[model samples]
Target: MAHAYVTFRIRLARHALADFIASFKSSGEIVVLVFGQVLIGLFALIAMPPMAASALPFYQSIPLLLAHGMAMSLPLFLLRRRVLPRDVVLAMHPLPIPPRIALAADALVAGILAGPLALAYIVSAAIWMSQGPEWLQADRALPATVFSFLVTCGCSSAILHLRARGPRPGPRLRRLTTLALGEPWRGPRIAYLWHRLFWLPFWRGDNVIGHQQSALLLGAIASAVAWTMAPAGIMGGVLDLTASASLILLADRGDKAVREQLGVLRPIMAAWPLQRRALEMCARAFSLAPVALLLALLFGAGLWQHTAGHVYLTLAMLAPVLLVAIPRFNPRARVGLVVASIVILTAVGSEIWN
Candidate 1:
């Protein structure tokens, strides 16, 4: 029975991974972005040992080492939700599967998600061994890598288990949102309704406000990191670009979710054209509000290395609007175009404008 359960989970995860990869393959831009990120990460890992050993002092290098390790393990952490889809989680939660078997299944799924990173680490390890640096001894590297893998997989699995069994915060979150939006007493009924509609995506999911909250959190963290590493050096430029890309991705997800919701309400929207227009306006405002605020934080905090950085930031700010405004291309293709454009703009800013 345990064997059957584990097998079922593996099959489900396989299907989910296939679907995820297909989505990635469907867009040339996304494929490029994915490959580009992987290559960049591989390069960083390959440079880690030498960088740690000689570039920075030992105290400074500790953070660098930890950061690189986290970077290597991040794929499994981020894609945990993707590999074990909510449906699969819901299906498996009621089973009588043993704890050890369930854990093993989760570790296997995490391994699958982190496969490319694993390969990258192996290559890095081989290179490090060939050099045999005294500071970053090759012997210690294997144990560190193994520990990172175990911790990452175990944490991801634990999070999955907790989320599956956790209480749904959707209802309470909706009430708070309603209160925040000035629902009954403050705004006009149609305006309130449409604006409320804009926020429906955040609170509708099993993970209450997970999507938008993540974007906000990332923006905050990026700003904080940039501020901490003041003077906007190479790392700052990279963080700025990376943060913008992450925000664009989050905006893409939120925009897709809102559009999906609107699609389901097409009949009602058609019946009330004013409501549709109002919703459109509300969504644009609501979606761009965070972008505006984050940009303000960046500017006020002096996080931009050069004035040209704002140009790329502006393009990122416009991405969500352009993503919805442009209708000729499919969403996936549109995303590719938007991301590619931003990347190019950032490259131009970094290479020429500075």
Candidate 2:
């Protein structure tokens, strides 16, 4: 039973990554961009701490490296959360698998999902050790680093277990959602219904910070940076572009949800008196409001920053919007288009800066 469960989870994780990769396969540039983005992110994860610690004494670097490893637990937990759905655990509830076996399988799966990050730590530690640290000092630090990695794995496993078995919002939360949507439903019934069924859970559920809240926070931070630093260097240009891309991507979360629901409800919705285009426009207006607000914030920040990079930043930010707006273009294609725009814009901005 344990072996079977583990096999199931491994397949599940593989499928998730496969699907995400497949989403970018239409364009070679996008495929390259997706893989490159992931590789660079993981490389940064592996290299940054050791690079920072290289200048410090072995003793000092030990704490720094250990702290960085501990900090990585959050990503591990998020990886597990992404790959391992709660429904899987719920499905296993009726099985004859023992509690210990179930948890063991979960821990193993979490470790596998985060294997790249763990491998990064291992590589980082090896590089750190090569940098003229005394054998005794290295020996002492190695055990602690190993312990920290173990603890990080343990934390992710615990989070996975808890999240899978965790209590959901119950009857009261449902009642609150209905109330918020209105007793008789406000605005277009289709829009209100989507909000009640899908969006509200993320907004008012156990997770306080949903997609919209995250976007707002991101916008605030980017705006604050623009207002304060108004950074003009090549690095700043690249950062501004990255921030703009992130804002659009975050805003797309809700938009994607709406798109998915609309797809599912198309036949039923077509039966209504409203024209199909009108129905789509109404649902989209309800969904795309967050995207619009985020774009406004991003543009406002670019103007306020008033750096040489501002013009390029604004242009790059608009690329995704223009690409996604073309009739018959898949709205979901924005993810790849946004990343590609960032790369092209950053390269151009760098050359111009030079």
Candidate 3:
């Protein structure tokens, strides 16, 4: 039974890899993305952390590196949630595979897609952990797989549970979201209306701050951990990535409402007297309200302490936003511009912090 399970997992992973490759055959950018990511991971592994931290006691390095690895990999899995109708998609053009088994396989494949990211996290940390007190040995490989497998299983199980519910959410969900956010505006000045949009998509009865409370606590914990265990430059980059990710989640949660409103209210918006610059500012404000406040707090704290390179590090955090805001910045360009930019910027910021 155990052997069968192991084989099942490997086969599922293979299917995911094949599917990913086939899906991207018409667009070669996926190959560039994969390769660029590998290069970035390599750079991060070698470039982060101080030379002294690199030589710390084995026990000290292990805990910090382990925490760092978990911090990176676990949050990635959280973002993989999607509304795909796994059952219907697979069933439409039926593979000969049995329904019970195939759906399970699909769930596993969905999770396995994130395996490379999880693998990078641990391998990068392990390299760092090995830097201090001891050279890495070959005999400890089995234990590493067990640790990484736990994260994979957690991701797989969450996706499988979501699949078992139904084929995506229906109109009832749309109705509930409509009730939560309230009716869309007909027409209004951008500045006058922009602030309301933050908590506008929230649950109807709950206080505006209720949902943000958990995120606030998590950010606090993350900051405390980073201050203690991570270098300043790296912490800034991490916070930047975290901020970008947080905004992405915020957008994801309200995507349907945003799209629905855009569809219904386009004519109204087009008729508004707001200038192009004001509209663009409102767009940025709507997207970045939550993160902007946190960034302000961090900058304030950094200023009070006269933290060196704080300005540079703070600017580095804005780089990821370019991925979303800039339409022409293709990450998979022949020269790998975006990947190189991130690696170099992250490294230089860390060096300054160090």
Best by TM-score: 2
Give one digit per residue, the lDDT tens place, for model 3 in 107-126.
55555665666565566556
- Residue range 106-217, candidate 2, lDDT tens digits: 6887787667766876776676667744442554555655656676677778877776674477897788867886587557766765565456656664333364456554
lDDT (tens digit, per residue) of candidate 1 on 85-132: 666667766878787776777666666666665676677767776776
For candidate 2, give the lDDT.
0.59
**Would you list the C-alpha lDDT of every candidate in the order shown?**
0.59, 0.59, 0.46
**RMSD values, in order shown:** 5.7, 5.3, 10.2
Count of clashes in candidate 3: 0
Between candidates 2 and 3, which one is better according to TM-score? 2
How many clashing pairs does model 2 include? 0
Report lDDT (Cα) of residue 172, candidate 1.
71
Higher lDDT: candidate 1 or 3? 1
Ranking the candidates on TM-score from highest down gives: 2, 1, 3
lDDT for model 3, please. Answer: 0.46
Pairs that clash in candidate 2? none
Better of 2 and 3 by lDDT: 2
